[model samples]
Target: MKDRRRFSRVPFKTEVEVLFERRRLAAKNLKDISLKGLYVVAPERPPVGEICQVKVKLTGAEPPVELIFTGEVVRHGPDGFAIVVTETDLESFAHLRKLLSYNLADPEKIEAELGRLIR
Candidate 1:
């Protein structure tokens, strides 16, 4: 089967905190992440198109990295919901880059995958 994903996603497991209406926060497990978005495993799925703030604390790094961003719920199913990231800072981008670099081998493959995302 052909993979239709734009950006290459690496399998990542981490705890993610999502804030929805009324500043209520829910903790969920993050399944995977790409440059564009992430997948969160949640029993109570949020409505599609709903926007929420997400905080992901990535450990195992030298000093750890915290990624805080706003995203929209693009898909929801039995497994979990997918979030399309809307906003992020430079620090988050750097951390994501580092994570991908560590997880993904072959620089040529990474270049090709990222090139597909641009086009």
Candidate 2:
């Protein structure tokens, strides 16, 4: 099958907290991330198209920046679910960009990927 993803995803294992309802939160492992989305490894799968808030703490950073974003459940499977980020704060986007740059071997590749997505 052809890959339909808009951005290239890199393996990123980290803690993620998903809030789908009021006073309810689920802690899961972030399996991977791209500029547009991320995959959360959790047993409880939310229905597709559901909008939720996700918070990811970047532990590799010095102060461990926490990124908060709104995302929609795009795909689901036995292991976990994939969320397409719909909104993010400026600081959160900056942190995510930094994290991706640190994890990827070639930063230019990400630039190219983003370029492709924009076009």
Candidate 3:
């Protein structure tokens, strides 16, 4: 299949601290993250088409940068669901990209790897 998404996906299992509507919730792990959205393996799946705010607290970061995105649950399951951010917060997205780029070990190497995968 031809990959159409304009985002590179890194397959890494990381535990993330998620917050929705000021409510603390736990997801299984992060499935993938792009400039547009994030997929998580959460057991407690939210209803599809429900719009909510999400904040992801990632490890290896000094302080948690709140990611304010208006996303709707697109998929529902026991494992997890897919959520696409309706609006792109440039500031938050840049912060997240920087954070991920730092922990990626080698930015150039990973980007090349993802490029191959995407192609």
TM-score of each: 0.84, 0.89, 0.65
To one decimal, what is the Cα RMSD in angstroms of model 2 from the true structure? Answer: 1.7
lDDT, model 2: 0.85
Tell how far residue 25 is off in model 1, in angstroms: 4.0
Give the lDDT of residue 106 in candidate 3. Answer: 66
Q: Which candidate ranks first by lDDT, i.e. highest?
A: 2
**Mind sharing the TM-score for model 1?**
0.84
Q: Report the error of model 2 at residue 21, Å.
A: 2.4
Model 2: runs farther than 4 Å from truth? 116-119
Better of 2 and 3 by TM-score: 2
lDDT of 1 by residue, 1-119 (tens): 99878777888998888887756556557888888899988887778999998889888766867888889999996888999988888888777777887887654566676576558
lDDT of 2 by residue, 11-85 (tens): 988889888856345655889999899999998877899899999987876888899999999999778999999
* Superposition error at 102 for model 3 (Å): 4.8
Candidate 3: C-alpha RMSD to true structure equals 5.0
Q: Write the per-residue lDDT of candidate 3 for residues 1-119, one digit (tens) a residue.
A: 99776555556556654556567666658787765568878777767787766666555567745556677778776678778777647787677667557656566654664465446
- Residue 53, model 3: lDDT of 68
| Model 2: lDDT of residue 26 | 62
User: Which stretch of 10 consecutive residues in model 3 shows the poorest summed lDDT?
Assistant: 109-118
Candidate 3 C-alpha error for residue 61, in Å? 2.4
